[model samples]
Target: MSAEIFDICVIGGGINGCGIARDAVGRGYSVCLAEMNDLASGTSSWSTKLIHGGLRYLEHYEFRLVREALRERELLWANAPHIIRPLRFVLPHHAGLRPAWMLRLGLFLYDHLGGRKLLPPARSLDLHQDPAGKPLKADYVRAFEYSDCWVDDARLVVLNARDAADRGAAIHTRTAVTAARRDGDCWRITLQEKDTGRESEIAARLLVNAGGPWADRVLSLSDQEGGEGEEGHRIRLVQGSHIVVPRLFAHDRCYIFQNTDGRIVFAIPYEGDFTLIGTTDRDYEGDPGDAAITPEETAYLCAAVNDYFRTPVTADQIVWSYAGVRPLYDDGASAAQEATRDYVLRRDGGDGGTPALVNIFGGKLTTYRRLGEAVLDHVEDVLGARGPAWTRRAALPGGDFPVTGFDDLVARLSADHPYLVPTHARRLARLYGTAAWDLLEGGEAALGQHFGADLYAAELRHLVAREWAATGEDVLWRRTKLGLRLSEAEQNAVADAVAELRAALPNRP
Candidate 1:
């Protein structure tokens, strides 16, 4: 066991865990975080990739959740403008489903419920004359356009972890927490390296179970019991899946389609060439990692889009697909779609000489910052306050520019690195913001080996050294979406390069 004890030890490196670590460390608390896989390798990466107030959630009467998420949209965007940007969503009215007046009322509430600022307000659209109507069916004459934020979901997780690490938090990827038991005023945590199978132990004043889909399993590993029963708090594993297809529309706007089954699906413009359609919510069993999109889900998504688009979307049109299991606090809602998205925090063993443990259940990406703040409230109650709340005004690493300064940053990057093509400059600016200069320090010559698709050694080195990226998937998929554009052979080359790079590291396992 390490003699040095941390103030808090976070079990998972997903959004919630990383976000907590960032907030805590920034507040002057000593923190350590462990992730069994690469950061954002789980549910954080496999999202619908929007930072929006849940518009459909209004039907469920989750006003507080919606309002909080809506307020977070602009705040989060300002904090990480490089990976998040404003997006307009078009909700076409279906005469067979929700009535037009009801839609208008819903839009009114959506616009007024949250403290929406910077983002444009909702407006009714005339599909007959608008460009957004061209790709949709002629029957859809009226639609409502509202603002939401598009996020690089995986990058959001990584940036939070990166910020936490930069703020003096110890982040360990590919490390798992095998066992934890309360030891007087601290929790003795057993950690195992997934690759080497080496075991080590550390102590923390408090332990946080932000395990996401694996929350229940992690709770079982600890000596402490969850509230009430011996089985602990039950988390409903709801699998939400998404698919990538050829771009469905030329416009930048996204579409939200309402299915007859009381579920909603989104079809958004993605990767400059593909349409991102998704999110089927269904009850799931077995390992969360093993969750994959079923054929029925594919057909359902195809039908959902085909219901509105002038051109039909077939299953064959799918270019890529993914599924993620959302570990929701089992509220006994009876239906997976009806399950609440609000988070539940359970704190135990804080007083009477026992160590503290905080179990986080059920949270969404849009409200991750707020979730972190809430978790800190519990932490302060246990560990005592060290610093005041400060994450709201802080900008994440490489995100110091203005929220609306994306174009100016791109133009500046292009001017600085004239050797880079327009597309390359724009991509770098979009991903790294001000840090693009740091990546391109030595000009074009410093880029080193060109793996493929403008992915060079300089960016790879930066991802490895700064972003905790050890594998090609971490770089190609999470850090950047180049996996969609790269050929298999090119991908293999990138993988080989990453392996060689990892092997050459001074601290290689």
Candidate 2:
């Protein structure tokens, strides 16, 4: 293949990198994005999976960050309705904790801060008389219900990469940029294939360091490559973790439980058969790829839920757990929870001495799209403008239909292929949106293999062919949440089948 020069080369296949690539490529810039591992194998996939403005952030008075996130909530939903949907949260009033008046005031500001058009406004609930209160303690007599959005976090990252790829950008997964040097006005980039130990060279007019947890590592590479100073800002690694257990409540509304230590934990309905609870903020050191939930963290999460729920959570009940380290811009906060969630963009070589390197820092999944727009604004400023910002209204792949039309799409999909079971059809429609037909082309009979829980070979092939899935974890956990549903032996069977399938495949991405 010819080493065609690119206008932009992004290092990272997480949400930020893919979002930027999609935006840049849509604007007519030649782009290439390389991920050291599977897309969103790190921070992006490990989020709380909510697209709402940070309700707890109101205590820190981060109005600007909250406003931007709130604005993107509905906008992102409209663009990717298949993977994004509205969710309601229940915040019960505690007699000795945050006063009811203060809670009301915060919700009021949250409602008006961002343009609240698509979602319903917040309302007070008589927990004693409401079904949402059935799972809560008797002491929690009253609560407030508010709106937010849920996202399939990993799928969001993959969809962004897919959109970028469809828009003419090359997405290189399981590939790492080993070296980068400034070659006059261009960046001489060296990429290593993780599997075969092969290396290749490419060139780009600009370089973007969107490596979330590895931002500093990639910036160090550029410094060694071009003799540039370590101009990238410092970042603090904060570990956040969650636990999933058998369903604790039948209600769809989630609970935002307040702890005495001034931290909040959420209990949300997940995967139809389980409850998702989590997130403890603690400073972390060492590699982010090895992040895992500790016994203490698991205990803390269980206790957090035990504090508010009638159905007490215990460590033995945890069916699955995950953890990820966030690379937050270091503002020297005393506590990890106190750290800022807002993003920072630092540009090097802006004075025309070498190729520009843009360093991304500290962002939430909720603001990824807006973050992309801001990144390209800097790129457009350094390089020549290619086209105006266009991602705000453009839907991601499989997300062309309206958010409310999801059930209708499911019905349509089942009708076209009568062989599909109702559960299978719903899963496909929810995951692929308008593109479900492409993944389920030949339906049940032609679906290469059946790996339990509606995870057929047809969908697996589509994930590998289109979404860059590699391992069983990538297929079971990220591509789909079947990891929690599949048994150990069943999981191994799927892994062996996928490995055999991978051997027959041409390339990783």
Candidate 3:
């Protein structure tokens, strides 16, 4: 088949890919994004779910990465106040770990290194008197509290992709790039739709390999022979996993506990009833797609959390789990935890300056926006004058609502949609932002069968129509995290409803 053409072709639909696509489209570049699986179905969703500079990165003397991430933290918080909120982490200084004074020094630099604005600075805390210390053991008397932001990483990626589509970018999910070859100044690429087995081709002026852990594999498939340019630049795949257990402590604050092995773990309040803990950094040598929390990893995470929390948790206490492989730029670091989280964008063109493929290396959710801007920076010279950077100030889709405060918006929503329960009202406000109005049409009159916990036909219809929610899992997990709250029977009902709906549609894909 003849290939359709675009200005840019972005591979992968994770945070970095979506961010780049969003920025590229907004800046007047025609973009086509191809994802082999669901958006954020990779490491993006499996993040620690916090948008903060790694305090430990400061220990590695990565001042630039930390400052950039810290700066982006506030920017993201201000932009997505509903989904992203400021979180305070209480660090209990254990005797064997880095000395309390050293931690305080690190926090001092963390506060001042980045331009401190809305978020509060770190302060010394006495575990005996401070309320944030009640959960820790008596021996852990001295501690420190620092500020950071928490983001729904999956939603962040989806929102970027949504905005990209809104700005004329074509986002193709369940589409894998089968081949990429250089045809003159453009790249001729073949994409196979995973669901339909239909093949289509697209030509673009530039190609981007943002395949996260699978970046090398994607490069190996590129038109460029043998992935030669990618030889020297190898990505170290590290597996990190998290475990969810019943809430281990009280208070809205999160705990950052230092483990005996020099690694740190977070025990944060998840949803309303669970505590999320984990992240074990282990070297991975297999396929990124098959990465999962093995029994050993699970036991390690459980033991890590059990070491810090006064109330010990075991494998039986784990309610759920997830794992992801981070494609870190290999610096030959001996330990997985020692690997740099900094991202590198390499332009792959010859000495004669042909427009080439840009490959993205390691990056975190906190730095995705900046990373997007940087990717554009690298491509700007190649594209000449594509467009100016506008994402720094632009509001994402559903984030059009003014920054008047989330509570006020929730109250306003509650007042307007009187039928919606407080939880339901808040959930809608948090998920859809200003777009909640779009779903509330027909009000109670249009509402249909309730599958419990704010799952209604009104919202589901809106999701299917606007958010590209193809399957029940899309609605339950990505569009909304209702999967955590929905019962097994309710989940089955959702699957059945979606299946029925798909069957009824004349043009179901």
**Candidate 1 residues 269-330, lDDT tens each?**
99899999999999999999999999999998899888999999988888889999999989
Q: Candidate 1 lDDT (Cα, whole model)?
A: 0.91
- Given candidate 3, what's the lDDT at residue 237? 96
lDDT-sorted candidate list, best first? 1, 2, 3
TM-score against native, each model: 0.98, 0.97, 0.95
For candidate 3, write residues 1-509 as lDDT tens digits.
Answer: 24467878999999999999999999999999999988888888888999998899988889999999988887787777777888899988888779978998999998988887888889889889998777776788888999988888888888888899989999888789999988788788999988789998888888988999989878878855423553566789999999888888778999888888788888888877798887889999889989899999888887776666677789998878889999998888999999999998888872254657898889889999999998887677787676678887787776765554888888988898899899888888887787787789878888898987878988777766666566788778776778888998998888788766656652432
**Per-candidate clashes, comma-separated:** 0, 0, 0
TM-score-best of 2 and 3: 2
Better structure of 1 and 2 per lDDT: 1
- How do the residues 1-509 of candidate 2 rate in per-residue lDDT, one tens digit apiece? 12699999999999999999999999999999999999999999998999989998999999999999999999999999999999999999978899999999999999999998989999999988999988888988999999999999999999999999988999999999998888898889999989888999999989999999898889777764422447538788999999999999888889998888889999999988999997999999998999999999999999988988897889888888999999898888999999999999988774564788888999999999999999998898878899999998999999999768888988999899888899888888878898899987776677977788778888878887788888898999998999987888889988887777788887644
Clashing pairs for predicted structure model 1, backbone only: none
lDDT of 2 at 429: 81
Model 3 ranges off by over 4 Å: 1-3, 225-231, 350-355, 402-404, 500-509
Q: Which stretches in model 1 have alpha-carbon errors above 4 Å?
A: 230-232
